[model samples]
Target chain A: MIEAIGVSKRYGETVVVDGVTLRLPRGGVTAIIGPNGAGKSSLLSMIARLLPMSAGQVRVDGLDVARTPGAVLAKRLSILRQDNHLPARLTVRDLVAFGRYPHSGGRPTREDAAHVERALRYLALEGLAERFLDELSGGQRQRAFVAMVLAQDTDYVLLDEPLNSLDMQHAVAMMRLVRRAAEELGKTVVLVLHDLNFASCHADHIVAMRDGRVLMQGSPAAIMTPEAIAAIYDVEATVHEIGGRLIAAYFA
Target chain B: MTAARDPRLVLAVLGALALGSAALFMTWGVNGAWGFALPFRAAKLATMLLVAHAVAVSTVLFQTATGNRILTPAVMGFDQLYVLVQTVLVFALGASAFAGLDRRLLFAGEVAAMIAFSFLLHAALFGGARRSLHLLVLGGVVLGVLFRSLAGFLQRIIDPNEFAFLQDRFFASFNSPHHGLLAIAAAMALAASLLGWRALRRWDVLSLGREVSITLGLDHRREVTRILVMVAMLVSVSTALVGPVTFLGLLVANLAHAVMPSFRHAHLLPAAFLLAVICLAGGQAVLEHGFGFDTSLRVIIDFLGGILFIALLVRGKVR
Candidate 1:
């Protein structure tokens, strides 16, 4: 379980993430969805310990994120941020191998190699393992990054807008992979997503945030109502149950 | 795609070039004074190699920290900062007294100042959220100008004779390095390598940018700070030894990248070091023997490296 107590992020006078305490359970997919300037990314970053909190504390499985060593937290938690620009050129395999750095420290052991191989195979990147990252297409490159995060073998994985630049097909593939990781591997996945329908379809729990505070939180079934959507996004939208899944049409 | 040559093979070729140049610098144009010339050339060779290693390693590390290829410690005004510190010391203590000060003590003081300045600059410029490339370049250019202008102002106010005394230390000269400081520079360089040794793996991870590296469990701030301190020590070693060679680091590091084409610092570091040695010891040989010119090697390198810097900027390779 990940617990954030009175989390707040203030940049000078502007409050980005307000003081809010929340608990994220240990398994399945939990998606944080919000409009722009809603502080979803900032809140996720703080929970992952990637960004420092102004006046709060986060505990990941009883270990205080601020006090615990990064290497220690790394074994239990891994985060893949949006729009990573690598300064150096690396092969897909070389990049995936870096996932074991917290464990291998650049000198990969036999077990570390096994993990790398597994991740590459999982992402169907065995053929492109030797290819440079620059040579891969957008979706392929995104899969390679996800492969690296998977090889980390962390119980909790935080992704900030994993589908930022992907087309519809790739975005669906990414969501399926996230759901599979949670179901098959029993990993707790927390992601900041922009597509409300995708989140409703894939996420077991939905967190709707607005103005730096959690406006609502519950299962997708309970939170996917028209009134709840209107309250969170200030949008006039109708919710339809299509094949037992709630889909919101707000684009009109 | 054409197969890239093995990095190790490239390393071997560069190693040979560095060694061949060292030999030529040591043996060429000898006139039956092997007894006296051997030790003198040996000292010069050692000093050149130490400075080469220091500058190459520091510049590569600095580039790594800033996530850009064009900016080096020298470009960030570290060399001028050293000169400024020296000029301030001379202004406060008088030229004669400053000149009378022990070279080792002076070197130590300059290195300490460089480390402090590097830390202050990094902390002030990179405050977690403001890491734009423009701001970094602007800060570096502004600071470089500030240090140079301050040093020039001090030089103008001082006496002419004292200024002449100070002038010799301003321009880089490989012909006359105090023998005593060579050992100290080597010691410092070795200490820096040792300090930087453990961070080697972390450097590769760091090249992935701050977000990924921190998520990979690296203490990003601490590691960058440590790398900067090591960079400061190295810049001081080179600047104190040869006054200041502005673009050698940039030239050699970029060349290393061009030839090696590997992101791993394991290859890049040694490749840069050997290239620097070739440029220094080898270029010195070519200048002293081939051209028979009385000009310092620093002048020729600065001329070429300045052109390369401009070309890189014009080519839009700042990232």
Candidate 2:
């Protein structure tokens, strides 16, 4: 479980994430939906300890995120940020193998290699494992990043804008992978998503943010209503239930 | 991606070539007394090898910390800071007093000052703001400009004879080295390399960049500070021993990356060291024996290195 108590981020007089307090339960896919400048990424980064919180405390499984050693925290939690400017020369396998760094400390053993191989296979990157990151397509490279995070074997995964550059097919595939990771592997996953329909259809729980505060939080069926959507995004979007899944048509 | 060459084979070839150059440098033009001439040549040989190791390792480490192949310690003004120290000594003590001071004391003072400067710079820039690596580089470049201008102003105001003496010390020279200074430098470089040797794997991860390194559980700030101190010691060693060779590190490090083409520092570090050895020893042998000291080794190296720098820029290989 991750808990943020009065979390806030400020730059001088401007507050990017202002006084956000929320509890995120363990074991499921939780999607954070918000508009631009809604502080979705900032909140997630603070939770991951990538960004320092201004006036709040974040604890993961009773361990203060800021006080805990990175090595200890890395074993329990892992994060993959969007726009990873990595070296293009690293092979998919080499990149994924780094996921075991906290455990093996760069000296990989047989078991570490097995974990790397499983990650590659799980991401369907077995054929492209030997290929360099620069040689792969955008979707394949995105999958490679996911494979690396998966190989970390952390119980909680934080992904910031994981579907940023992926196409429709790849985006859906990534969402499915996130769901499987939560349901099958019993890992807790948090994602900052842009598409309302994707978040509504895939996420087990949804948290809506506007102006750095949680506008609403509940199951998709409750948060996907027209009133909630208007209040959160300030757009009058009709919500339709098709195939027993609440899908919001916010584009039109 | 193209087929990758085996790093071991490349390293072996570089090691052999470096050894061959050293052998050739020692053997050529030994008509004088064997006992008298051998130690003299050996001193010069040891000096070249030490400078090669210090400059190459420091450059590679600096690039790793900065996450770019283009920026070396020399480019960051480390060598310029050494020059400033030398200029200040001459300006304060006058020519005779400066020359009369104990060379060992002077070397120690220069090295200590450089390390102190690096620590101050590291703390001031990286302490509170958590400034990015590029910002630090920009600060270094600005500081380099300040140091160069100050040194130049001092040279202009000093006596012409003193200026002549100072000018001679500015350019790098491998022809003659102080035996005492060479011994101290070798010990220091050896110590730094030992520290570097244990952290070779960590360096490989660090080269990935700051965010990735931190996410991998490395204390990025602490690691970068340690690497900077090592770089300061190294830059001081080479610059104090043979003066400043600005482009040698850039040339050697880029060549090492090109040849090894692996992210692993285990292969990259030795490859850069060996390549530096080859460039210095082999180039010195050719210039000393073949050209009869008609050309300066620093001139030739900077010429080739400058050209390579421009080529890298044209190819957009800064990353």
Give stretches of model 2 more than 4 Å off: B89-109, B120-140, B158-172
For A112-131, candidate 1 gives per-residue lDDT tens digits of 99999999998889999988
TM-score, prediction 2: 0.93
Fnat, model by model in order, equals 0.73, 0.50
Please state the CAPRI-style docking class of candidate 1: medium
Each candidate's DockQ: 0.73, 0.63
Most TM-score-accurate candidate: 1
Q: B167 in model 1: Cα distance from truth in Å? A: 2.2
Candidate 2, residues B129-151, lDDT tens digits: the string is 45664576578779889989999
Could you give candidate 1's per-residue lDDT for residues B155-192 as a string of tens digits?
99988888887887765468887566788889889999
Which candidate comes out best when scored by lDDT? 1
Collision pairs in model 2: none
For model 2 chain B, the run of ten residues with the poorest summed lDDT: B125-134
lDDT for each residue of candidate 2 in A25-102, tens digit (9 for 90 to 100): 899999999899999999998998888889899999999988999888889888889867666568899999999998
Instruction: After the best TM-score superposition of candidate 2, give how far the Cα of residue B144 lies from its true spot, in angstroms.
Output: 2.1
